[model samples]
Target: MRVSSSIDSIYQNNVTLAQDLKSFVDTHIISNKYEKWHYISRIKSLESFALKLERGGISSSSTSLDDFFACTIVVENSTQIDKAKDLVNKFCDIKCKRPNSNNFTHKQSSSFEFDDLRLYVTIKDDVTVPNEQIKKIVFEIQIKTFLFHAWTIAVHDLTYKSDEINWGKQRVAYQIRAVLEQAECAIADILNLSKLPQLDKNNKETKALNKILNVFKNHFNKIDLPSDLVRLCSNTSLLLNQFEVKENQLDAFLKAETSAGRGTKMLGLSPYQIVLLGIFYQCEDKLLSVLMGEIKLSIKIVITRELLDFIQPDIRKFILDNSIPGIIVLA
Candidate 1:
C-alpha cells in the first residue's frame, strides 16, 4: 500500500495531541473573551496528504522520517502574541516514509503546513490563557499580533532581493526591519489600547480611521446597503487605497485567492462593489477552486460544508436564518 501523506488521525497520539493542544489554547492563551483563536491543523494535514504522493511517503518529508507537514492557523490581531509561551510538547514516530521520484516537487502547492503555528492568546487583565496541549514535534504555534503579520509581508518581499545570501538584501533589509519594528510597536499599542478605560472619538488614530470610514460609509449608504458589513468591507477598501488602487471599480480586482484557514479574499472589489451592486466572479471548480474568471461574485461564499459540521445545532439554525446565500451550507 502507498504510504499516505494523510495525517493518520486514526492514531491515538495524533488525536490526543490535537485535543490537548486545543484545550491548552482555549483555556490559557485565548482567555480574552473578545479575542478569537482557531485550530489550523487540518489545513497542514491536507497539504501533507497531497505532497506525500510525490515523496515516497511521509518518511522522506522530514528529519524524523515519520512525520508530515501541516497548515498554519492565523492570529486575527496583534495582541495575541503576548499570551504565547514556549509550552509546546513534541512526539516523534520515526516509522515514516521518504521522498522519491514519485513525490511532488512543486513547493507552492500546499497551504497545509507552515514553518510554524501561531496561537494568539488575548492580553487582558481578567484571565490568563493556557498553552500546554501542542505536542507535534514538527508543528509550531506562534502568538503574533496584527502588526507582526504586516511585518511578515514586508520581510517576505525582502527575502527575494537577490541570489546572494546576505549582501543582496542589504538596503531592503533595513526597511523590512523597520516594518518589523513597527509591528512590535503596533502590538504594544493594541495591548495598551485594550486597557483603556473607554474608546473615545478624540483619539488621533481612531479619529483618523473613523473619519476614513465615515467617508466610505456615506458613500456606501448612498446606494442603500447594510452598514454592519462596512467594517470588513472598508478594511478591504483601505488596504487597496493604500496601494494607490486608482481603479475603484471591482472589475479592476481580477485577483481573488483563498487559503485554507484564510477563508476567501479578493482585490479591486469592495463587498459593496460586488454583492451590493450585483457582480460575479467565476473560477474553475476542482479540488482547488481558485481558477480565475471575469464573472466575479461581489461576495465570495465562505461557508463550506466542512465548517458546518462543527457547529452546534442551535447556532447552525441561527446562521441559516441570518447568513447570505451561498455563504454557508445548510446542515
Candidate 2:
C-alpha cells in the first residue's frame, strides 16, 4: 500500500484540481435555479490510485487520471438527463460519451447494472486554474437520476464491494435496482399520462370526481386539491348523484355564494363547506327525512364555523329550523 513520492505529488496536485473544479461547478452548474439538482464529488485516494496503477501495469509517468477528480450530478428524473448534459456542455470540453448499460436490455440474464450518462470532460480553455497543466486532466462527470443514484449508493457496498459473494444479498440488491429502474421509467412518463386517453369517462364515480375537481378549479383557480378534500369529494360524489345535484347546480350555487359575500361579513366558506352546503340547499327535504338512520353514517361531516353567519337570510331559516344533527349545523 506504499505510494512513491512522485505519485504522492501527483495526488496532491489532483486534490488541488478537485477543489478548483468543485468551486467552478458550484458557481456555474449547481447554482442553476431552474432545476433541483444535487452534486457529489470525490478525488481518488492515493492508496486506491496506487493499486489501480500496479494492477493495470501502468506507469505513473504515462497514466492519465480520468477518474482522479470525478463528480456525479443527481437529477430529478431520467427526463432531465439531456438537460443536465446541456448544462455540462456550457462549461466543460467533452472528450467522450458513454451511455448507461441500463438502456440496453440484457438478453443473457436478468440483472441490474450501473446507470450513468458518463461524460469524459476537461475544463474549458478560457477558465483559469491554479496550474495550467491540470486543465488537461480529463475527469468524469456522471449524470444520474435520483433513483439510479440511490440504488448505486445503497447497493454498491453490499454486493459489489463485498469480500465474499452472497447470492441472496446480490439478488435482493438487483431486485431493488430493478424497482428503482422501473420507478425512473415511470417518472419519465408521468407528465404525459394525461395525454394518452380517457379510460375513466364511462365510470360514474370518475365522472363525479371530475365534476368536483372542475368546479373547484373553475371557482378557486386551484389545481392542487388536498387529499382529504378529494376523498370527501369521492365519498360524496355518489350522494350528489343520488340527490340529482348536477355540476351546473354546484356552479350556480358557487356563483351565488361568491356574489352574496363580496361586501359582507363571513365573506367566504371553505371548499369542504361549499360542497356540503350545496348538497344541503338542494336536497334539504330528502336529507331531513333520513337524518336518523344508516344514511347519516354515509355522510362525511366536516365541522366548520356556524352555518348561520354564512347563509343567506332565507337559508338562515333552514339552518334555524333543522337541528339536523351533523348536517348544516353541528352545534
Candidate 3:
C-alpha cells in the first residue's frame, strides 16, 4: 500500500508538471496568431506509465512520467510548420529535432514525424519546490501540419499500438501514407495560390484599402465578409496602385456610388463581389480583365443581377461595351 501511494504521488506531480508546460507553450504559440491551434496530452493513468517503463526501462530520477508527457501543434501548412519550429527553437531548448520525411516505417515517422521538434524544458530554481523533489521534469513537443496530423491519426487507428509485424497491413499503410503526402503537397500549393501576398501594414495604400473595407463592415454588420474583403482589396490595391489610384479618389468614388444608390444594394453582395464591382468601376479594361481571371468562379456568381443593377451607369456601359465574358447580366 505504501509503495502504491508513492507511485500515485509521483504520477500526480508529473501530471501537474505536464499541465504547467502546456500552459507555457500555449501562451507562446497563441500570441503569434499563426500558431494558435495546438493540442496537449499527458499520460494520466499508471497503466500507461507502466507500459512506457516496461518499453524503455526506468531512466529518469523523478519517475518515468516525465518521458510520457507530450504536446502536438498542428499548423495550417508546411510553411507554418517551419515557422513553428523557428518559434519553438527561439524559446524552448530542443533536445532533438526530427524534420519531415515520407517513409512510413522510418523511426521518426511514427509520432514526431514531418518537421517536428522535441523540446526539453527545466523548471526554474526560483520556484518554491525543493530541488530534489521535482528536479528532472521534462516533456516532449511535436509539431506538424494539419494534413500530417490527420494522416498520423488514421495510421495510428489502423495500427492500434501493436508491435506485431503484419506485412500486409504495413504495405497498405505505406501506400496510404504516400497518398497523404501527395495530398499535403497539393493542399500547400492551393493554399499558396489562394493566399494574398502579405501587405505592409504601415503603407499608405494599405491604410486606404483598410478604410474601404471598414466602410463595408460598418454598413453590413457581418463578421465573415471583412476578411474576404481584405483579401480582395489587397489584390485589387496592388493592381490599382500602379495606375496611381490615390486614397482620395477611392473615397470620392465610394461617395459618388453611395449617393447614386449603390451602397444599399451592396449590402446584399458578398464581400468579394463588392470588391470586384469596386475594382470594375475604378480600374481600366486591362486590369479588370486580369482580375476577372483571378477571381474564383464560385465567388463571381455571388454578385447577382440585382446587385449588379446598383453599378454606376458608366461602369455598366463599360461592361456592356467591353462585353466581358463570364460577367453575369440580367435580362
Candidate 4:
C-alpha cells in the first residue's frame, strides 16, 4: 500500500511537471520563432510504471526514473538542434545530456537506430514556478529532426514495438529509415548544389538578403528572421553597396561598445536593432547621405524611424536635443 501510494504521488508529480514543462517551453522556445517545430509530452502511465517496477532489472524506484515525464521537441532540421540545446541549458539544470549521432556515417545500408539528442534536466532555481514540483523531479527532453521524428511516429511502434516482431517487418522498417536518412542528407546538402550558383548568379538582392539572414541565424541561433525587417535592411545595404559588413567586425564592435559601458544603455534594443546598429556604424556617412539626400520623404521617414527605434535611448535623446540638422528634419 505504501509503495502504491508512493507510485500515485510520483504519477501526480509527473503530471505537474509535464504541465510546468509546457509553460516553460512556451515562455522560452515558442517565443524564439523557429521556422518549424512542435512539441509532444506524456507522463508515463501508471501501468507502465508498475510494469517497469515488476521487471526488476533496473532501478524500481519512481524517483530514479529520468523519463517519468518526457517531452519531445521536433524541429524542421538539425540546425535548430543547437538552438534548442542552448535554450535548455539556459532554463534548466542539466543532469545528463546524451548527444545524438547527427553526423552518423552509416556503414550498413540496412540498419538504422535514429538516435536523437536527449537531455535530463531539473528546473533551475532561477526560473519561477507555482510549486517546487519541477525542482524535485528530473524530466526528459528529446530533440529530433522532422524526418526522423516522422518515421518514429508513423512506423516505429508498429514494427519495433509490435507484439509480433517478425524479421521481415523489422527489415522493412530499417529500409524506410535508410530512405529517410538519405532524404535528410539531401536536404542538408541542397545549399551546396552545383546548379544553385548558376540559378542565383544574377540575383544580387537575393544574395544580400541571404547574407543578412545568415548573420541573424548565426548570431541569434534562430531558423527564421522577420522577413520585412530583413528585406528593408538588405535593400538599405544594397543601396549603399555596403552589405559586406563582416560578422567578426560586428562582433568586435559590440564587444568594444559593451566594454565601454554602453551595455546597460543598449539593453532596450532587440537583436534586429543591434544588427542594424552594427550596419549603421559600418556605413554611417553613406547611410546618412542616402537618407538625407536621395531617398524620398516617405522612405526617409521610414528609415529614420527604424534607425531611431534601433538606437539607444540616450543617443535618441542626443539627436533630439541637437536637432541633428538633416537627420530628423523630415522625420
Candidate 5:
C-alpha cells in the first residue's frame, strides 16, 4: 500500500513545479477567454501516484513522477477542444504517445480512445528544485467539452471505480454514454450555427463593435463570460449594427453616465450579469424583452436605468419602432 520513498520524494520535490505549470496554464486560458470551466491540481497522495505507476506499468526507480501532474480544461463545445490543444501547444513541448492497442482485437484500446484529446506537455529543460531529488517535470493538459466531461465522469463513477462491474450494468453504461456523445454533437452543431459571422476587422461597424467589446472586457477585468452569455452578446451585435452605434458615441455615453452618477454600480452584479447588461444595452426592444424576462426584478430595474442612460434619442426611437406590444415596456 505504501509507495517507495523515491517516488514520494519525486512527488514532493515536483509539487512546486506542478503549481507553476498550473498557473501558467490558467493564465493562457483566461487571457484567451477560451473557456470558463477549468481547474488545476497536483497529483496528491502516495497511493494515487503508485496506482498511476501501476496502471502505466512503469517502474518506481526509473520513471519520474512529473507526468502525474495534470490540469483539465473544459470547453464549451467540441470545436473549442481543438482550439484548446493549439493554445497549449504554443507554450509547452507536447509529448505524443502512441495509442495502446488491445492484444485480442489488435485495435486501439477503448481507454486510449477515451483520452485521445489529452495532451502531455513537459518542461524540456531540467528545473532546479531546492533541497529535492527531482530535476525535470512533466504535466498533462486535457481538453474536454462540457458534455464529454459529463460522460467521462459518469463512466468513471459507474464502471472504472465501481466495486462490482456487472455485464448488464456495463452494457447500460455504454448505452448512456452513446446518447451523451450524440447530445454533445448536437450541442456543438447548435453552437456553430449560433456563432456570429466573422466581421471584417477594417469595417467601421466591426471596429465599433470591437471597441465596445474591449470596453466590456476591461470593465470586467478581462474575466471570461459564460459561453451562453458570450453568445448572447454576439447575437446582440446585430442590433448594434442596425442602430449604427459608433464606438466614440458609446464611449462618450459611458463616460457621461459615469460622471453624472447614473451608470449602474457593478459591485452587486456577477461578471455574467455585467456582461449581460452590456449586451442588453445594445439589444432591440424585442430581443431586450426576451433577455429581460430571464432576470430578476432588481436586475431588470438596474438594466433599465443603464439602457435609459446610454441609449440616444434616435436609437430609442428605432427600438420603439421595432417593439412588439405587450412584450416590450420602454419605460
Candidate 6:
C-alpha cells in the first residue's frame, strides 16, 4: 500500500530516533567494556510497540500525527525517565553550541523536541552512572509489546485487509488496537517487575519468566533442553500431586512421552535440560496471562511430570536445589 509522505517521515523518524537514542545512550554511558549490541540486543521485547494500521499515511481527513504510530517506549520508573530527559537536553544543548565550549560557568541550551510519555521500563531506582558515563549507559528501556518483531505479523496481514476486501465488524479492528495498547501498558508493568531491586517488591512470575526466556533464547539453538527438563518436572509433578492439585494428566502425559522417548532425542534435546524447559514453558504461559494474576498450578503439574520422563542423571541433579517437595507446582 502507498504510505502518506508525512506518515512516512514519521515512520522513518521513529526508527531513526529509537536507534539514535540507543546509540547515544550506549556511547555516552555503557563504557568501552561493553559492546553496543549487548545492551540493545537483549531487548527482544522492544518490538511490541509497533502499530500496524493500514493507510499508513495522512489523508485529507486525517487530523493528527499519531495516526501513523511506529510504537511507544515507556519507563515505569519515573526517575529513569527524568534522567533520560535530562540527558537528552544536556547532550543536545551541548551539540547545538557548535564550536563553543560551554563550561561550569555557562550552561548550554537548545530546543529539543519530544513529548515524554511515561510507560514502563521496570527499573527500581533512578540511579545514574558516574557523572562521566551518564551519556552511554541508561538504567533501562521499555518498549511496547507487539505481536511480531518485523514489519508485520499475522495480526496485521490478516486483520488489516484493504486489497482482499473483508469486513466482519468495525469494533474488531478497534478491539485489536485496544489489545495492542494494553500490551504496551503491560510491558511497562513487566519492566517495573524486571528491575525491582528487592525480590520482595517485584512480580515474581514476570521476573522468573523473563529469566527463563533469556536462557531459552540464548541456548535453545545451540543445544537441546527437554529430556533432562522432563526428568526435573517429574519431581515437581509428584510434589504437586502430593499437594492434591488436579492437573491435566493428558498434557503431562504428552510432554512426558515427547521428552522422555525417541521423539525428543530425535529432536536433539540435550543434557540437563529440564530446568530450562520447565521454566520456559511455565513462564511463557504466565506471561501470556499477565493480565490475569492467577497461576496455573495444574498445568505446571502436567509439564513437571513430562519433564521427569526425560531426566538424565546429570539433568536430575539440577532439581535437587530448586524443587519444593510438598508444594504445588505453579506451571
Clashing pairs in 2: none
TM-score of 4: 0.52
Candidate 1 off by > 4 Å: 1-71, 76-78, 82-137, 157-170, 190-331
| Residue 24 lDDT, candidate 3, scale 0-100 | 61
Instruction: Evaluate all candidate structures by whole-model CA lDDT and list the values in order.
Output: 0.39, 0.67, 0.57, 0.62, 0.54, 0.37
lDDT of 2 by residue, 137-177 (tens): 77789988888888888888889767798999988887897
lDDT of 6 by residue, 203-256 (tens): 654444444444444434534544454443454444334334233332443355
Shift in Å, residue 262, candidate 3: 8.0
Deviation of model 5 at 111, angstroms: 10
> Quick one: best lDDT, which candidate?
2
Estimate the TM-score of every prediction. Answer: 0.27, 0.63, 0.49, 0.52, 0.49, 0.22
Task: Using lDDT, rank the candidates from best to worst.
Answer: 2, 4, 3, 5, 1, 6
Q: Please report how far candidate 6 places residue 172 from its true position, in Å.
A: 3.3
For candidate 1, write residues 54-126 as lDDT tens digits.
Answer: 5655442232222332323345554443333332211222222122122463334422122223322222223
Q: How close is candidate 5 to the true structure, as a TM-score?
A: 0.49
Number of colliding residue pairs in each model = 40, 0, 1, 0, 0, 33
Model 2: runs farther than 4 Å from truth? 1-5, 33-35, 57-63, 100-111, 126-134, 165-168, 190-206, 220-248, 259-331
Please give the range of 10 consecutive residues that has the lowest summed lDDT in model 5: 294-303
Which pairs of residues collide in candidate 3? 100-115
Q: Best candidate per TM-score, number?
A: 2
Error of 3 at 311 (Å): 12
Candidate 6: C-alpha RMSD after superposition: 19.0
Model 3: per-residue Cα lDDT over 123-210, one tens digit each: 4444334233443565566777777778778777566566686867767777777677777777778756556466212567667887
